[model samples]
Target: MRVAALDDDVEELDLIKSTLRAIGHDCHVFTEGAALQRELRRETFDLLIFDWHLPDTTRPEIVQWVRNHLQARIPILFVTNRRQERDLVEGLAAGADDFMMKPIRVGELAARAIGNLLGNALKFSREGAWITCAVEALGVDWPVRVEDEGPGIDEALQAQLFEPCVRGRSGTQVDGAGLGLAFVRTVAQRHGGKVLLDSAPGRGSAFRLVLAQAPDAPPPERGQGEAPA
Candidate 1:
């Protein structure tokens, strides 16, 4: 599997890299947040592994960043010391596919990695950590809006806001999984839908999803279920 490992601690990174290599997976390690962000443009990994804290960004922020910036439903794993249920819930809410505590579980990591690889290959299509599917109970028309802080789609291209594999040039170093957005776009179009980009350079982007009610979308159960992403 193509795995990306991010951590501020050099020694910890080395140990994780060694353990993963022993299992025979290609691992990419990044210590600097900006460099890692840049590298995301260049590569698409099967698994993304990182710490809960980073020099430049928090785990939740990085997760949210990926949801906002990339469309691919790449499985993300968190290796961190944040062991509280609240912490785990926060991480899960932020988009972590799974969260593992520190003092690393090498064996479990291997299993989870294999499982994530299989799970992603089998399905792997969605927008966020959890999918914002239509609520069957809601009326046909729903409140939705598209906001863009950039110049427009034209500027989105300039800013690398579109799909990674789209027309945008790879001038900026980015290690991104280049598959999700295309699916998002395709699915949205199939449903006679559209995505609104609420963003701008230095401002940020938020894409509002609006769709016709899905006759197939199941009703919400008692427990909060995972979103489609």
Candidate 2:
């Protein structure tokens, strides 16, 4: 993916650039809003990352400009040091798809969440079965759905599907540690959201990861000895 990142701080820009590149994305860094805008006029990018504060602009002005002027529905993410509720509101109100604090680990969280979902879908579904992935906007939440035409899950197992090391009856047929869904649940809850499953004996499973449009607070500290399931 081609990504455009704007930040006035040199160190922050370097961090953003390196992190994106490490995840196989082409990242273009800008020290000023004008430079980024100039590039946007002549080039295209798959994603945009913006800092809440810019030396020449107020909060989210560039984001507003992009929403107002651009025709494409590109995903925009805000990575900044600001943590106030109103700052989050303003960023989302200006049309950012997601908001996160500074000192981020780049795409690790998203990659892990979605990766596990897709991996499970592939594992559970029979060979050549259809697996669909989609993103939908729901009022103040974004839900990523992964639907698979696999042997549907039982209600008894669904209840404990997100629990660590828990698996369905069919789990024994598949090679897994039963940790994927648990990790997905943890990631969603940390963002003040949740993971939901829709399935039945005959109907295939659809896993929906719903995340808040903007974070309400900083991620809670993990408990001592906590680890991914």
Candidate 3:
């Protein structure tokens, strides 16, 4: 498989590249997130490995860009030294398939999963239609919503929409395995939360993923910083 590994540490990048090469895979290394973003515009890779903190951009910003711009369901992994549980949650919520702590292990890079909610909205919506994603605190739960102006899902299809391999009529027009919603459901459940869908024919669709805030998590300040995306 072709892989792209991004990290500011030259030694770490070399280690990842050599390990991947030893496993008979091609690896492209980048020192800066912007450089990787530029390469992604013209090149395609089977997997992407990112460091949580980058010099030019953040993991979430770049990950969101990849999901929205590339529209590819490529798996992404984060290999970083940020070991906080909240860090892992934030990383996965940012659309990464997996998160790993550094002190790189040779065999630890093998895992796969993907979050394609934004990509699906982009694919199913009409050209120039509006798509908005928002994150807000609702009591002890954080609700992340992605709303799009597209052909609304039918009530009958919504019943089984999150089931693996199930798709709506409009889904037939798109190219996917119908596992996106299922993956979302899995992630939500694993986080002690649930995913909800609200839609009807012609009224568009809204997906809400509500995650429970950790008991030790600090409460959000009223107007201090921007809400996490």
Index of the highest-lDDT prediction = 2
Candidate 3: C-alpha lDDT: 0.74
Candidate 1 vs candidate 2, TM-score winner: 2
Q: What is the TM-score of each candidate against the true structure?
A: 0.47, 0.51, 0.48
Q: After superposing candidate 2, which stretches have Cα over 4 Å from the reference?
A: 105-229
Choose 2 or 3, whichever is better by lDDT. Answer: 2
- Compose the digit string of candidate 2's lDDT tens values, residues 11-123: 98898798657645589999888888889989987778888877677656787778777777667878877878988998898888777776554245766787788888777
- The residue-by-residue lDDT of candidate 3 on 56-152, one tens digit each, is 8888898898899886777788887887899899999999987778774322311111136666677778877887766677789867677777788
For candidate 2, report its TM-score. 0.51
Between candidates 1 and 3, the lDDT winner: 3
Instruction: Score candidate 1 by lDDT.
Output: 0.56
Superposed Cα deviation of residue 133, candidate 3 (Å): 1.4
Q: What is the lDDT of residue 207 in candidate 1?
A: 48
lDDT of each: 0.56, 0.75, 0.74
Name the 10 consecutive residues with the lowest summed lDDT in model 1.
143-152
The 10-residue segment of model 3 with minimum total lDDT is 106-115
